[model samples]
Target: MATPQWSKFFPDFYIERLWDKCIKCRRCVSECSYEAHIWDSKKKTLLEDHSKCVGCHRCEAFCPTKALIIKRHPSDFREHALWTPWFIKNIYKQADQGGVLLTSTGCALPYKNYFDHLVLDACQVTNPPIDPLREPMELRTYIGPKPESLEIEEVNGKFRLKKKLPPLIRVEAPILFAAMSYGAISLHVHQGLARAARDLGILYNTGEGGLHASLYEYGPNTIVQCASGRFGLHVDYLNAGVAIEIKIGQGAKPGIGGHLPGEKVTEEISKTRMIPVGSDALSPAPHHDIYSIEDLRGLIFALKEATEYKKLVFVKIAAVHNVAAIASGIVRAGADAVVIDGLKGGTGAAPTMFRDNIGIPIELAISAVDKRLRAEGIRHRTSIIASGGIRCSADVVKAIALGADAVYIGTAALIAVGCTMCQRCFTGKCPWGIATNNPELMKRLPPEVAYEKIYNLVKGWTHEIKEMLGAMGINSIESLKGNRDKLRAVGLTKEEMEILEVKHAGE
Candidate 1:
């Protein structure tokens, strides 16, 4: 089988060999799977085939004498400010393959981060800041339908609440592990996430990948996704999850289906996903069963019924132009929680065009949906979980203040487990082993090590959230949820502020 030829649009990489430091040990040649380094026995020299380099840094890091230097291939193309080097390179890449340009990890394109523009308020002389060490600060959050008001009724000669509220999944913090499918990442990574979710007392999603049997024990903290493929779904699978998420779209690839290449569908993954090994695991763009809001509602209730009405049913969607209206519909349709994945979310693989240039920012989406739900008098009926580029505790705080009941962290979690965001997940050769499924590479990242890293990351973020809450003279994360008054926008237009429902910083 011959592969299609493609022009080298971007300089794949450049390598510099320092003769003085070169030990000729060929460590670089041994480490680099790209075949970027070579040993010339005739000349007794170490040479670099830089064209093979993807700038993964595997060889450069392993060189004992540090004899090799790896750099991005210089963009020698005539510089046009209007049509940047990246734009030109992309054009050339597409021109060569005439196929969809697949990319992985988060979009590297510089998009406006709305969370950065929004500032959280702190206490002043009028309101003294509470000492977090001495104060009772609360971060526990519940995701599900919240009753507007509880009515007391006489039951068995005793006054009791008429209707108990819907079942809610409680978390110690307002951050849950975002969905990154099993096929996208490694089995060890999944194990780490399962352990982390159980240890963190939060939730980790089984992203459309189907539940690995090993993770069934972590069921109480897992949210199993039901996407277009309906992969790995059965009575046992449905019952294993504490919650069921109807994944309509993702932040990175809105209106696009997921494609796990045939090579990635190994026997284990195939069995778990109920698909044939070495076959493409393709998910459709939209759920064929769902077309209208009524259809979406029907699916949500169907999941509830399938779960015997005990599990929380969540609807996850990309932050699109009509996100607010969509969220309203989702809530009215009986979804317990709504997850809004913003434009900047990470993915295992997505088309370059859609990943870079699609979807709305998360901050704006949360505000709009929160405002719309409040106006419709159904704000309490569904919780909001915001995901997409939630980097720090500040981002989480800002998201909650804007309207999110909780935040979902994906790329950040990967980073904690040694993902460098090289944007090469599609290659199935992640150097850090977080994204790759290859047995050798996957073993480099032990489940214990990854779990510890995740625990530390979550713990650090939790403490930071508490610190911020104490500074704001608020002790509970729930108080911060949808408290837009605590947020002020900087360098935003009146229309933006109106949409954000936040005052200008000076105001």
Candidate 2:
């Protein structure tokens, strides 16, 4: 007998089809981009290939009769501490492919979630909590440099500023849509994010991918990025957005660059990214012109000069060790804002090793950077936008208390728009259509539908943030920024507490 393919024998997901409930509509067969379901005319029944399923649940969701149940496969190896099933399977996969393992989304390791270990303080007897319903709560946030002091001249009781203020980008909330490249995700998803950001009175980053011409009208709410590749960068593109970001590194793969396969580079993406339609888009690990902090400063000023100092310039870096020091340098180098992406940050595709092992959690990084900037008295010189693993309204509240001026949401936004996080984004076959470029799959998510869902998501989160702020006896988000006193640690060590600058829960 021929040896069996063990990988096929050990399927990750099992599709349970209820023959009684199934009406032969074959919707699941058509809906599944993974081709896990097959119709056998000779047998006059639908057949399943369990090995093909990536567990996206598209087939289950689209099944007209609700007959499909995608469940974890009922198979396991002997439990071992060091030799886990995933590790063993990965080794097997490598033996077959002999290539780097690739994965999508964020880190999935079972690391300690510091956000869960921290609790927010609420007003009691000493300070009564404000009622958000009865009173106004300020959630509006301003990004960019703030003047050290304001000098005023009183002219007939009318005050005017003595010096011109630096440019500032204002948002209705302390929430922003994270950077996601155009080719990495479908244009429909991009349009949805743009529309949602515009309607929500917030900003959405146009990742390393260049902005599409159709999105120029939403420039006021967009943060255009200039990565190492410098793709599609031009004079007009430089001035197209309210702010420009210099992407030094990504939290998903900090030390490496980016690669968009030639197959994904459609005409639209090619035009936007300024690369050939059938050519791979490769970004260098570092900007050739920027070898040091001083080099970074030159590029920062060059961008400012290119934009005539009209746009706010930001510098983004992964949350690595001494991130606070790096952020300090970025601010000194003339960045109006510094964005820090942490370990839990998501990506379209990344090597499995970097995604799991690199970078620190955003919670600690935010706190450390905040403490460092405040101590140096340059906190006012730049705004800090925290990202990577911000999940819900509670996470947002905790992040602000930990000292993030604002937070960016990527995976959460996608989840709002029907993403199941199957981690198949790199395959260009996202069944839900959120991360795919396939024409048929892209139709799954209409931009208008995505817009409504994302809009509702932000609106809901904003309401919850207001409630949290009111409970803390705070009427404005500004008060919550860098307010470590409003947070207390739970089940954390003294070392962790010192790093986070929070007291134990009881204390």
Candidate 3:
């Protein structure tokens, strides 16, 4: 293809000097999308346009040319550091904020070995192992309230309904997509998640920003989130979903307000959120209506009433130091499920310090919260959904074994498409457009292709999870939940082992 006229305006320009290695194959020109090279038949010269090069290094990677060398344009960052006001101010601000700056997305932080520190147990020679392929492997799970005990009453040769609570919501699999706000991502990304969830028979959460009109068709698969901002929340919003999540705190930016800068608050985002255009959409640190657990119960009941008690209510809280106690309070606050987010969760944008530090890890938090709830005998009453830094099928299995009824994935879902975790999503300049709000960039992610990628990733993970469960001599996920008895902690302190309630191997 011929180089387009617009290539002249490219900011960076560099020449590749291929002296002895130029085979005159013309492969570089043929392979490059930018059309930066042209064959000069008369002079036997390969004319190149340095300006049009995108620096993708496609030619360099393929080039047999030990002779070709590409160098920078030399003006990358000549400006003095002290002159950049924004950089200086942020540096000082981060210095003042002692909290590990939290962020959302996949695990952007350095990987820790907490998950490896704990090990899953399988039946040895004493017990026979179940063959997952030949025998049945049950991964079916329910996400709502479970009856304390089913009571039967004989009435005229028929059983009467004696259970006072609602029926449990069953899912074939225990994995679900966590809420990623409509405004944070484009409509296509939301649709991709919605469609993928529907295909997989799992749930997808709508962040506090509210549901887009286009996604209303996939309502059954969606769990609408109601956070402090109350964006796009209404009676209809409440009624139009499988479940409602009350977002108390996000693992990414816990204890800090979320600010959708004026630049991203375009007309559509503004309308969906019921906020003014070009205004900063801020989510306060605390829900004004919920000052206490009793007050939280009031909000929960209000939503239940608005939804006619047809949907499950979930209270999502960041995994803090005292999260176990907080989770107990949430269960008492009338939540059908508790969604816990750990420190490694992703965010659209967060201060540097907050992203690096803040909150407890999901592994520790899940173990603690599960222990607390089980001790109180409320574990089975309300489901537990753990999120933040769930990178693969192993993490999901570990989480379920640790006590989570289900696992919520955020960043992993994005990675299935094209997110590089460049950590520049807040700037709205994502090259792949998965996290940006810009129309032109957003168009890069076609709904059909994006959905397929997400579906494939989830499907792959599901199969892997089944394999892991099968290897452990387990047939069902329910048998795995809070089955810490099957797990042993290695290289942990006495206090850590005590808190985790796991004994050393051979003990």
Candidate 4:
């Protein structure tokens, strides 16, 4: 196949060099590989190609006097209220490539985070605040089926709980690193994430990319994804992980397959993914074996039997319009847990249209799922793990209150390890070295350094969660889960407040 014709219609950005501060060091000229800067031999000065600049700020980072500045290129096109500049640029991109305009990172649309509208109730005169330092404020979370209530049975004249609960993974905090494949990010990044998961006693998802041989030691801390491609899937791989996640969809690109371009399919990635080198590895849009709830049940039970039912089986789906109904079906399908990826979820690469336009926000999805499950009396039958746009401790706390058993951290975790969210992951030339495969680029990130950063990030978030719980006079995260009474919605419509199951502020 011939390469699709494509070129930038306009210079997206330009570099501003403060000539007064420039010491003629030529660092900008030497650092930019796109040839954005060139020496004008005739005039003994530097010239910049605005079109070549991607606004990565690589040159700005290394400038001694901070003389270099990167800014959006001034546009001459008359601004249209409806047809924005970005919208116009995307039209040109597709017109050139004759393909979807792919991008990386989470949605960049101006969608309001419903999490910001919900306020947590705190202790006042009637209720006194419990200092976490003096109280046992617990953040430990377990993801899996939970018995609604304990049923006592007499065994050998001793009363014991008769319920045989399904398997669950315990973590020190409610934060779990979301799925990110080795092919999507660098091997060093995977190692760093795995190390942090191990240290934190939390899980890191292996995102449809088969487990690398080196990460086998961290198997107990892994959640291996069995995507439609069935990449690197085998009994041994299933046994290696603490849990198996049957991926139905991702939030970024719903109703579509995963795309890892051939350029990212290096020798090691090919080996791990069980795909040929230099071949695109795409996960089929739909799981051919699963079309209905029964089909889903079959896959879930099959996985349970394969691991001898030792590991919890999870189903991950993008949060769509009928997410509550979908989650209901998943719980009834015998999944131990359901992971919902909201509209703002991050991805290695996705079409711009789908990333911004599809799926429901995680905040709404979590509340809807929780309300639906509770109404059906199945909320405790399976755990709800919410992902997509979960950035900080407050987000985590709010997610639990909205009915998520635990929260998945992706972009925030990446940011903790030095991701700038430049949204050029598909290019495989990440400036911070977190998302690229090039050896030199990967060298910019060290597993040891990344491990510490991630560990510290989660550590700080965990502390903040405890502080929030203490301020609320709640000593445990369990008390916060699905506790809509403790939350009040502000600056939201009455319908929105009703759907969220939270009272309006000052009500």
Top candidate, metric TM-score: 2
* Top lDDT prediction, candidate number: 2
Q: Which 10-residue window in model 3 sums to the lowest lDDT?
A: 3-12
Error of 1 at 19 (Å): 3.8
Best-first order by lDDT: 2, 4, 1, 3
lDDT for position 161 in model 4: 79
lDDT per model, in order? 0.88, 0.92, 0.80, 0.89
The predictions' CA RMSDs to the true structure, in order, are 2.4, 1.4, 7.6, 2.7
The regions of model 3 sitting more than 4 angstroms off are 1-112, 154-161
Error of 3 at 382 (Å): 0.7
Tens digits of per-residue lDDT, candidate 1, 1-507, equal 665444542466788889899889998877765666888999998887765677777777778998878877765767778897777767777787788888986657777788879998999999998887898899999999888898999978999888876788999888999998888899888999989989889999999989998999999999999999989989898889899999999999999999899998888889899999989988999999999999998898898888899999999999999999999999999999999999998899999888988999898999999999999999999999999999999999999999999999999999999876668889887877888778878887899988999989999999988999999999999888889899999988899899999999978
**lDDT value, residue 221 of candidate 4:** 92
- Local accuracy of candidate 3 as per-residue lDDT tens digits, 37-141: 777889987887886554545456556665455565543434785654334434444565534443345445565556777887777787777777788888888
Going through the candidates in order, what is the number of backbone clashes in each?
0, 0, 13, 0
Q: What would the TM-score be for candidate 2 when compared with the true structure? A: 0.98
User: Which stretches of candidate 4 lie above 4 Å from their native place?
Assistant: 1-9, 23-46, 153-159
lDDT of 2 by residue, 175-244 (tens): 9999999889888888999999999999998888898898888898999999999988898888988999
**TM values, all candidates:** 0.95, 0.98, 0.81, 0.94
Off by more than 4 A, model 2: 1-6
Compare candidates 1 and 2 on TM-score and give the better one. 2
Better of 2 and 4 by TM-score: 2
